[model samples]
Target chain A: MIRDKLCAGTALGRRIADSRDRLYRVALAWCGDEMLADDLVQETIETGILKSRQLKDENRLYSWLYRILKNAWYASLRKNKGHETLDEELLADEAGPFSNCQQLEIVVQVRQAIGRLPAEQRQVISLVDLDGLPYCEVAEALEIPIGTVMSRLHRARKGLLGKMTTAPSGAMTANRILHLVE
Target chain B: MENTEYSLDDQTLGSFVDGMLDAAHSETVIRAMDQDQDVRERVHQLHLVKDLMKVGFGHTKAPSAHSKKTRLATWRLFSPRIAASVAALFVVFAAGMLSQPYVNGQPGFPGEMLAAFSPVLSDSDNVILHISESDPQQFAAALLYAEKFLQEHRSQGYQVDVVAHAGGLDVMRADVSPLKLQMIEMLSRYDNVHFVGCANAIRVLREKGINPPIIAGVSTKDTAFDHIVGRLTSGSWKYIRVDSLVDNPGSA
Candidate 1:
């Protein structure tokens, strides 16, 4: 039967393998934490599988998965009583915190800066800048028009520039300084 | 370390960095950099800043290694019936004509009839457009049509969102054209009309030092144009060409 043929072609295995990284990165960006991102990615994958039948075109597996991720992010955010402030301590420099640790510090600051962005801007930057998806692809995943993607990316970059330009020089620590240089 | 000063705006510089400039323009920037210490320093600073940001943000850990355990656990949770349902449809095509075909005016194929008669159908109201052309007039006209359509339909409880992607984003830029400026202003009045530009475009633009305002629209989804086309073909939502809307309002 045609149905049996369709069943055999269930692309769940391939879809999971291809989207694992993208889903993880999206989750990480949304939650701004590693463990949560992992959990979200897992949840997204499971949901993607359950809803695979709804995905009429298997070629669009990644976009379909991303839609599920976006939905999950929103649902989680809503249930959590909207936005939460980023923990400054995670970003603050510690005494003599690993000299030549500029990379770690810069990473922290960047993450903090990203956290400061509006949810939509953050999502856009994460998918395009961090994940390195093409603009068209990012548009598909976000389910927005490409123009919106460009706008959000612009805002996010501008926000980053503002944050970095204004951040105190000494407050960055030597490690953070080296991180920027290297 | 001298600060860079030059007449070129950030967007122009950004375009230069993005390699979007033609030879003559690039020659001009290169000559300016040679003659102006401040401009040179500024360009250097911009490069440094971009590198720093890329380093800070680009280091994402691989997801597959971390998610393997959780995926297995979740896979175990599927009930046999549910799993069968998920796995069964694929098998239906292999088995010949398991369900009776019903006549709906035209003889309905099994799948088509089932889709039509399905009790759990949900309405797809989302409309996403891809505007890749760069003509500001066409872009503005599209926005005008979208505004009119949304205005007419919102009270009828319809949700319409207009998003411009790629070259179409020029219309949303503050400096593009007077017509575009008015389009952006008027389009913003409707809470439902979302204007978005592509991030890749922004990155390319920003690298050249252009600072365009971020439009309040959804970020671009890859291959989303195809998705929109698919939806239009399926009668999910009416997809109107901007020109068609202007020329043939009744059909659009």
Candidate 2:
């Protein structure tokens, strides 16, 4: 029994370490504040470790961790009350767009387009399209019906098509395109 | 493979794009796409959207990935001392369990006792009002309704969070909102009230190279309605859509 318990604990630890990067990226996408994203990830990992025993099936670990991360992000939002904690000077030093000009432009355009989607649709798109989770898993994480997930993902993709295609070639940035659309 | 008349619905199409469909249904959709140009184009656009989203968000790894020391610093926040305390408590409880009779197990200590002593705060009332209108008159009407809401429930210790987004950003802008002074006064008067603007809306203006004057007191969220929806799903929050509220005042 002791040996089995040790193996289970190690397996849960490995699962958490494997998911850290994906969880951080999703948190950043959801909140757009780097500091808050870090806080969310840290809290998620800590909570996962503390409550790892409650998790019954090993096969369900992936969706279970995603649910924990989502709940942690929401709780942080409630506690902090919509505070912006992104350090501009720090971001400028690191992650301030790469030298690959065309690739950089495409990235900016896509990010802004995703940002413009309605909040409900954006959540579904973030999980399904960006994070590459299955539709059923996305529904489980958000605690919504599966049909709602499909509809939201459809609307989100349609919105992105308009935003991505309508931008002026070469000369205009995402904000100008967004302003024009508005 | 000759089912051209059987059109695929949005959910089926989306499921196909996400690879959630079974092999048999997936083959049917592919066959239909080959026969219909419209279906093919939509399937392609949906694929493009998914690819674009992946390129946008997937490549941007957290900066903490590069700094092991910084990651350790964050881990330190959880504290080994607290973990040790929890571990010690578990060991002591285990010893007590082994020493006792197996008759009932006595509700297993601490969690049940804590629950018995804890007060019920779940009965408290909360609400969220989302204002998505740019009209100054609408803003005034929404604020008036907020005032009435607080007056009725302030004695009961109710909480309210007001969120503004999209064209709603205008209501929180100092240069644009006609009720800017009134907003400032309301902020000072009500400790329970909060006004939040959408951060993505602000980012759009900044990226356009047009900086507008913004009011000082309002907070900025990643998305306004998403925050409200999160609260609504978790707890019993009476959600008042201020745009709709202004359209039908008697119903609100």
What DockQ does predicted model 2 obtain?
0.14
Candidate 2 regions with alpha-carbon error over 4 angstroms: A1-9, A82-99, A168-182, B1-8, B65-252
User: Which is the leading candidate under lDDT?
Assistant: 2
DockQ of 1: 0.07
Q: What lDDT tens digits, residue by residue, belong to model 2 across residues B90-142?
A: 23334443232222543112332222222112234465666666765446445
What would you estimate as the lDDT of candidate 2? 0.59
Report the C-alpha displacement of residue B78, candidate 2, in angstroms.
32
User: How many clashes show up in model 1?
Assistant: 61
Residue B82 C-alpha lDDT in model 2: 5
Candidate lDDT scores, in order, read 0.50, 0.59
- Candidate 1 is graded, for docking, as incorrect
lDDT tens digits, residues A51-102, model 2? 8898888766756777887888777757765352321111101122232223
The estimated TM-scores of all candidates read 0.42, 0.49
Give the least accurate 10-residue stretch of model 1 chain B, judged by summed lDDT: B76-85
Report, for candidate 2, the interface RMSD: 14.3
Task: Tell me the DockQ of each model, to 2 decimals.
Answer: 0.07, 0.14
